[model samples]
Target: MFWFVDGEKSEYSGGRTAVEIKSWCTEMTGPAVKEISSRKLAEEQAGTKPICVYEGPEASTDFEEIAARKRTEFTFYHVAVDTEKPTVSVQHKSEEPVACDDLTFDGLKKCLDDNTLPLFGVLDGETYEKYMTSGKGLVWACLEMESSDDLEKVADEYRPLIKEVAEEFKDQFAFLYIDTIQFKRFLEGVLGVTELPTLAVNKKAGDKLKYLYTGEMTAPKVDEFLKNVLDGSIEPTLKSEPVPSSQDEPIHVVVGSTLVEDVFQPDKDVLFEVYAPWCGHCKRLAPEYEKVAKKVAEAGLDDMVVLSKMDGTANDSPVESISWEGFPSLFYVKAGETEPIKYDGPREAEGMWEWIEEHHSNSEGLKERVAAGKAVHEEEDSEADKGEEL
Candidate 1:
């Protein structure tokens, strides 16, 4: 049963004030508890709250029974309240109990909200958002949902397989079934699921990689697929645009297919930008970015340094560490380094040039190339000085 204690009151009834306790539960706490319960069970739309509030001396035995059941079996959320010690604890079936910070109404609500979801469930828009950001990998079974009967048949076929895998790998992944009709756009556009009754896994919080199962749908096959995904045996499917035929602009155009080839060259330091065409900020930065590119070219540093931009909306970076929260996000990658350092300074051309110069001077590859007489920047500067002297 859900627990909600009024923060204003200091003490709880211990069989002496049963009448007062019942009145408080019915009138004051009823509405708020019902609201929290309803929101949590919105997927079922079960209006009634499945809670039984107990008070006084006999409650101790009930709490013990609930705790024992939680350790031995798979059950829903069970909350234990110690009014005298004035502590709150929440526990789900067979899982460790978490102590709530306070006895306030909001505290109880948060505890239940965080632990109420089952290990295996249907994926709706709301639950999908929750699970994707939960820092866990997701395993999805795409089922045809054109008709109620079809949905039921497909669900029945895949439910056992999903449940089995969920039990075995609950720590690593969240198992869910999604309606093909409901998430058609996502399936086709992101995961490239053309057929129904397909299995897919997204390593969202880890490598941000995705994999699809190709063979028959069975518990063992699905288990093997998940194992391979964890062990990195399978290649990930990437969302990439076609590589451009030519890059003649000062800012070399980068696509996902050519990310490693162009930006991650071991002998060249790179200033990379991820921008969306529709973004006003990106549009505003275009001229200044071109100016920076031109400065690099004129200085004869084009071979040692590259100015590149990628349309973040159309392509995904093959480098898993590369990501952007907004358009026109900039990063600097030194030669022979895969890690990208974020550029968060000013947006003007002069400021960008300063940042580039600072990193370039510190580049080990540039030093090595200059020592080997492969880089001409030093020679260009010396010749310019001589010309000035003459």
Candidate 2:
């Protein structure tokens, strides 16, 4: 006789009666089984869907092949179990099938969670967040999805080419098509896509560096663009204001095109400030930063040092080591060093001067200038004292 609990086989006792078996089950499971049954009943009453699994015999090769072929079309996973080799593997659409290292229930759940996203699909709000956090680079085809017949024709011409490239690089990157009208702001503001049928790639790690494709939309051209992005041969696209015609203020103005020349000078120590025009913190720090710049100029340190500022909202820094999460970010780049040092001290002029003095590489000319300035100050103080005595 078999004892069943909650539709699952529990135990077998050949000599026990029904009453004895019921008593034995209650004694063994105690309150745990009752609690589980209550929860299951509540879920069923609440219309919660249960997880479904499909099983086929080990000898069913036809079923396995069909499942493998249709895996990308459906939401369910196709797991192939090899009875002879005793291995479990999941099929992928464009890449080789991945073998599961862990066969436990939790391990299989983790594997499914990791590989659930489609190889290529339309990019939407929900899928954007998922793909960006998946640690994979994304290739976006920005097309006019709901526009006129002419625009629709343009999209139709490019969609197939994008899909072909996606299939070829499926294992390296996740490809997606975006609705240009729906994501117009993002395209213009972030990716710098002013025209329709634009293609871009975002390497989501670290700084989320992005590159734009400007070539004709063909399968081979798109493939070459993606290859250039992966191999680091293409320069990342960045938002930038036009370079200033003249920068004559105490604080030098910097833009994306002039970043390497102005703020990253190898022969001079540079203090750079990145600020947004609307930020209250940047507004408050403005006067103090101006004071610091004037002081640097007055002290005859302009030759050895440079003070510069950039509108962070309107421009992007090309320096690989420079990035900020907040406005009014300050960085100190020493002479001959590309790595920047963040300033975390007080925002006042004197505090900034102290920080700069401590960080700047002192040369003989700088030392002589400091000494001469000190001597002139001492002479002026002595002359004032003599006037008081008279």
Candidate 3:
């Protein structure tokens, strides 16, 4: 690394070779830095930019890590590059096998760089910087080994397994990963991963991580586990990001104090179960509500019912929503209207769903499964036809 010297300065034979930049921390480099900076006082020691600043002791458990961060001794190695852009690659140092999908160190940086718009690495760097600074949506996964050697050996063995499992689940919707930091996250998140090869599924929920499962790692096992989760065979102990409220669209969680201002009126008949958490009948209809939330989705009420829970408390009356004078407020709100056709019934999830079938006689969802104009209640129709014959 030759110094940038003036051409007019003919007496100077040439510039100096690679100067080492040094920084001193108040915790570590007191005497050594003082000795080095004192040498810079001489004219021969000119044109050296040693960014020496005192960094106070950080809240760290590992001294080696602290030292590693502070002791960045860069040697000017020769490499031809058109641009002065810094490159990044993610390394997963894990014991348990890592999943390829979870192996995002490289891809993440690439995505950021591409989207950063002419600021290849800088925008990406900004994203990471924002994460580190604000501590927003940050995920930190760590593991402790007997030594660094032990960690390396674990990584060697676990990476392939991760790759295979990730491949198996790639077609599916779930994001499965078991790499270095991610693997460690699985262990810690699943509450002390006891097994040698542990796989943890964590879905990001609002402001917190919802741990799906932490157990033995296998492609088939994970496949079954993921299926069960989707089919509702396994009721997720921790509330996940509320799996796909609408097909092929991102989920939108109902935050507190949000009124459904954007009214989506259904062109066809729509069924909706207005539920409140406090209603005693609503408690009875909890499982029923789950069924309703599902039925509405299945019915493809993407814009229909709008899946809203308006707080009907006297103090906070949301959007002039009519209270279920009955137990389970089963109401069918016609599209483009402030009112819904009240399907008064036992305020329950099932009852709310069933009410639509009984009243409308027009199964909006059933039409898709059946023929275009097939009968909504063929069973009742047959009975009525038999009565006429009798």
Candidate 4:
């Protein structure tokens, strides 16, 4: 029977009911029974759509509201308090887990190219696209520590637990690993992961739903946490807070870490700058960046193309997510793509403006901007030539 304890500590409530929900769940799904505390926690697990039992004191009324809000996707069993043999009304629903495999980023791409499905394993930078863009799923990604002994120790400790849990629930989840030394940019720069040997899950619904494991690193603790995750007992911690919205500036100031949603999801063509405030180069380019923003706005491509900046040096702004080679580095994001397109062009206002026009999807508007810009340049040239002739 499933126990629904009220306090933080989990405790069993009463005896087995006439129709036990846990037994029924085990029988139907083969050992997938989980004990949960509240309806709110259950709803968080709705993504995975597990069989959730709410036996809290308020189980009677709570499950009904949750089932309705969840749109009848998950199977719910509510335990009764009044009777020794509590009757459970099972609401059945069909659900499937997101399929993933263990491969490096490039290997993942090759699998995609070859149209093959992979079993979960350690991943590299190239394979980031496979998991991040899938739109929904769980990726239990771990950052490997450096020292050989420490690395071996973590491997020795986690390998068994990962192997055991992943084998049991392989169909329902994807497990991935990364060497912090190799794919330094992928996690630290892209995901804002500061803690070494950290495990984070991408819920894939939104950036807000991506959570990192902040608990102790023991195998049992980790196992419990993963179980909690699988059973929907935990909510995802945000990778970065919501980038505050404002309409005041021509350049969209990326005040926080909503890069995946604000930049990637909508898939607007973007010329984004990652800069350190202390860097002289970033300071020098700041004025020109704003000018480029204004020039793009003037061309009426602000909606289609965005010019934005993030302070890579800020405490909240993860240096990992920005992962720049220098103080100020620019990346262009194309519409409908998850991977960033690196910008190697000149950083001047006119040069940046021309690049935006070159990539802009509005062909006619691009032509108009090009012609107008050329006309002004030609006029300046003609005047200069006249003065030289005189």
Give the TM-score of each candidate. 0.65, 0.69, 0.25, 0.39
RMSD of each: 10.2, 12.1, 19.5, 18.8
* Backbone clash numbers for all candidates listed: 0, 0, 9, 14
lDDT of each: 0.64, 0.65, 0.36, 0.55
Top of the candidates by TM-score: 2
How do these models rank on TM-score, best leading? 2, 1, 4, 3
**In candidate 1, which residue ranges exceed 4 Å CA deviation?**
1-115, 125-130, 133-135, 147-154, 187-195, 204-207, 361-390
Q: 1-390 in candidate 3: lDDT tens per residue? A: 211222211111222343322222222233222222221232222211112211122211232222222222210111122334322211111212111221133543243222211101111222333222332221222223455446545544544654555445433322222233434553443333444444333232122222244555565766577656545566423321222244442222332233233222445444444445567866776666566667656655544344444333211212335434443455556555667566656556666556655544345554354333245467778989999999
Better of 2 and 4 by lDDT: 2
**Tens digit of lDDT per residue, candidate 4, span 98-200?**
2214233343233232221133444544345554544445555565666533543555556655655555555555666666666676566555577766877
**Candidate 3 colliding pairs:** 97-158, 98-162, 98-178, 99-162, 265-335, 266-335, 288-349, 327-347, 328-347
Error of 3 at 258 (Å): 4.8
Give every collision pair in model 2: none
lDDT agreement of model 1 with the native: 0.64
Lowest-sum lDDT 10-residue window in model 3: 114-123
